[model samples]
Target chain A: MSYLKEKILKDGVVLDGNVLKVDSFLNHQIDPVVLKEISNEFIEYFKDKEITKVMTIEASGIAPAILVASHLNIPMLFAKKTEPSTLSNEDQFSTNVHSYTKNKTSRVLVSKQYLTPDDKVLIIDDFLANGEAALGLIDLVEQAKAEVVGVGICVEKSFQPGRAKIEDKGVDIFSICRIASLENNKITFVEDEH
Target chain B: MSYLKEKILKDGVVLDGNVLKVDSFLNHQIDPVVLKEISNEFIEYFKDKEITKVMTIEASGIAPAILVASHLNIPMLFAKKTEPSTLSNEDQFSTNVHSYTKNKTSRVLVSKQYLTPDDKVLIIDDFLANGEAALGLIDLVEQAKAEVVGVGICVEKSFQPGRAKIEDKGVDIFSICRIASLENNKITFVEDEH
Candidate 1:
């Protein structure tokens, strides 16, 4: 987590005193080496949970989810933002998520065949700001009758209500990098709280 | 490659005599073990190319591209389908791509910081049918003046014109599993070709 924290301090960009842009190595452009280490960190944090599948949302979270899934030797399922024409119209779980960035609401869905009641799911994502996407993923998992063991995030905005929302759901959330605030073009880390 | 070929034979679903769905292990739901093997196969095929970076589009391609980048010890850049507000509006390369599935054309963009003229990129993607996405990615690479050593695909429909289009640009294309035809729910692979 320290490595991730340091990487955030070094490469992460703070914009409008709130948004943290890690496009250089975390989101848009990925550093697979750092990503491997991040996934290993997640595995270390949740190794005892007996995770059956690692889940994430499409686009940004897929890369880290792949690393976590690969290291854990588990399958990864990403909830699609758009329903692909190829997917059958049978037995699917879905929920609507509002994106503050895109300023729109989109339905995220996963086929029931991928998730089952017998599976223990670990939800992973790139960023947890307002936690809408994470909540949507949790909804999909619940609809499939699977239990969510925990939520693993690469970066969390502590100033936002995302953490409180997920915590209110009584699900344990783990983030590698926790930001206290982004002010005056500077990033502050959430210290003494790992 | 044989493992992937066998996986396609075993789990791939042929639909509408044209669409081949390997969502069970490749796209929607990812098998990390198979993905690791597939990335290794790509590495073996392009080991001599001195790839500096691995590139792909968002959503599906990020998983395989991560494995390839990790195995090769390089960076991975995914062209974003929509430009995130967090990304700086400076020094970016953009291209328009038509998605057959979504039935729309969207602009894909990548920051210029990720790709450079000296970088040799290996483009990776989940499927190559019409090659529109691949061509768009190649355009992004070209805009940055980067060299595309090769394009790696998980599943290629040789029955389609994707291969010929990419080959016309004189870049090498490698596919783990090549489907000759998908007719009547039967998947036919291109034989005696690796």
Candidate 2:
């Protein structure tokens, strides 16, 4: 988490008043070395839990999910934003998510064959702002009758209510980097106990 | 490669004499152990290349690209299918790609900050059918004036024109599993050299 914080301070761009852009390493362009460290950090945090699979959404979350899956030696399932023709029509679970960034509500889906009652899922994502995407993934996991062990997020905006909303549902959450504020164009971190 | 072939025969679903679905291991619900094997196979294929970065498009391709990048201990950059609000407004290298599955065309963009002239990229993907996505990624790499060392595909449909179209661009391509034909719900592989 320290390495990720350092990278963000060095290369992360602060836009507007609330957005923290880390396309240089975290999202668009990925640093596999740093990702590996991030992956280990997630594993370390969830080491006590029984995680059968690591689940995430498409695009930004895939790289980190894959690395953490590789690190923990667990299978990863990403809910696709665009449904491919190869997907089976009969056996599938779907949900609609609103993205403030894209300014559109799109349906995200995963095959019912992937998630099952036997699995213990760990939901992971790159950013936790409004927690809409994470909530959607949690819905899919619940539909499969699988217990979500916990949620691991790379970055969380403490100014937002995503953490409280997810926690209100009784799902434990772990965020590697928590942003306390982005005031005066300066990035601030939340206390570790938060 | 043998492991991949076996996985296809065992779990792959043949559809309409044109599609082979390996969603169980390659996409959708991914098997990390199998992905690791697939990643190792790609490493073997491009053993002699000096790959500075591994690149792919979002959604399905990100999983394999990260695996390969981690295998080589390099960075991985995934092209965004849709520009989120978090991304910069700076000029990006964009290319249009037509998806046969969705029967649509979409723009794939890579932040110029991630790629540069000095980078040597290895493009990887889950399925190479018509080569539209691969070509778009190659275009992005070239737009940055970078060298595309080669392309690595997990599953290639040899009956399609994808292989010919990409090879025509004069870039080396390696596919771990090549399907020669899919007829009557049967899957056959193009003779494996390995």
Candidate 3:
């Protein structure tokens, strides 16, 4: 986690309106070494959760989610934002998610064949700003009668209401780097818990 | 590579009109073990290429690309289909890509900060059906004046014109599993060279 904090400070850029762009190493352009460390931290945090599958939403979430799933030796399922024409089958579990960046609501879908009542899912993403995508993933898991073990995020804007929204569902949230504020192109980190 | 061949034969479902759905292991619900092996194979194939970066598109390609980048100890960059509002800056390399699945063409963008003329890129993707995404990625790399050493594909639909399109660029191509034909729900693989 300290490594991520240092990398964030070194490579992350804070834009106006609390947007922390870690595209240089985390999101758009990724450093596999840093990403592996982040995935290991997520595994260490949730080692006792007995997670069966790592769930995430595309496209930013897939990288970290895949790494976490690889380290956990579990399968990873990514919910698709676009309704793929090939997945025309009606046997999918889906929910509507509102994207603050895009400012629109779209239905995210996952095949029921992957998630079931016997599965314990860990939801992972790159950023936890509004938590709508995580909520939508939780909705998909619930529809399949699967248990959500927890939500793992790479970066969380603590000043935002995303944590409160996800906590309302009673799911434990763990983020590698928590931002207290991103005001005036300055990043303020919250006190580390681990 | 035989593992992928067997996996595709066992879990991949051939849908109507030559669409091979490997949602059970490749695209939707991913098998980390198989994916890791595929990444290793990519490393073995391009061991002499001195690949400085691994480039892929969003969603499916990120999983394999991240793994390949990790093994190669390099950075991975994914082209975004939608121009993120956060990245509204004009300092990006963009190109149009036609998605056969979505039946639409969209611009894929990569930040100019990632790729440069000194870098050597290895393009990775899940499938090489029509090769539009690969070509789009190649275009992005070329826009940055970077060298595309080769392209690594998990599964190549050899019956399609994707290979011809990519080969026309005079770049090397390596596919883990090549499908000679997918007619009448039967997967006939091309003879392996390695």
The DockQ ranking, best first, is: 1, 3, 2
Q: On residues A1-194, what C-alpha lDDT tens digit does candidate 2 reach at each position?
A: 48888898888888885889898788888887779878888889889988889999987888888887877788899998877777766777999899876678999999998899999999999999999999999999998999999999998998998999999999999998899999888998997733
Give the worst 10-residue stretch by lDDT in candidate 3 chain B: B82-91
Write down the RMSD of all candidates, one decimal each: 1.3, 1.5, 1.3
lDDT of 3 by residue, A70-158 (tens): 88889999999877666775878889999887789998899889999999999999988888998999999999999999999998988
Local lDDT at B23 for model 3: 89
Looking at model 3, residue B64 earns an lDDT score of 98
- Report the lDDT of model 3 for residue A43: 93
**TM-scores for chain B, in order?**
0.96, 0.95, 0.97
Summarize candidate 1's per-residue lDDT along B26-63 as a digit string, tens digits. 89999987898889989999989989999999889999
Interface RMSD value for candidate 2, one decimal?
1.4
Query: Highest DockQ: which candidate?
Result: 1
DockQ of each: 0.86, 0.80, 0.85
DockQ of 2: 0.80
DockQ of candidate model 3:
0.85
Residue B26, candidate 2: alpha-carbon lDDT? 85
Candidate 3 to truth, TM: 0.97
CAPRI-style docking class of model 1 based on DockQ:
high
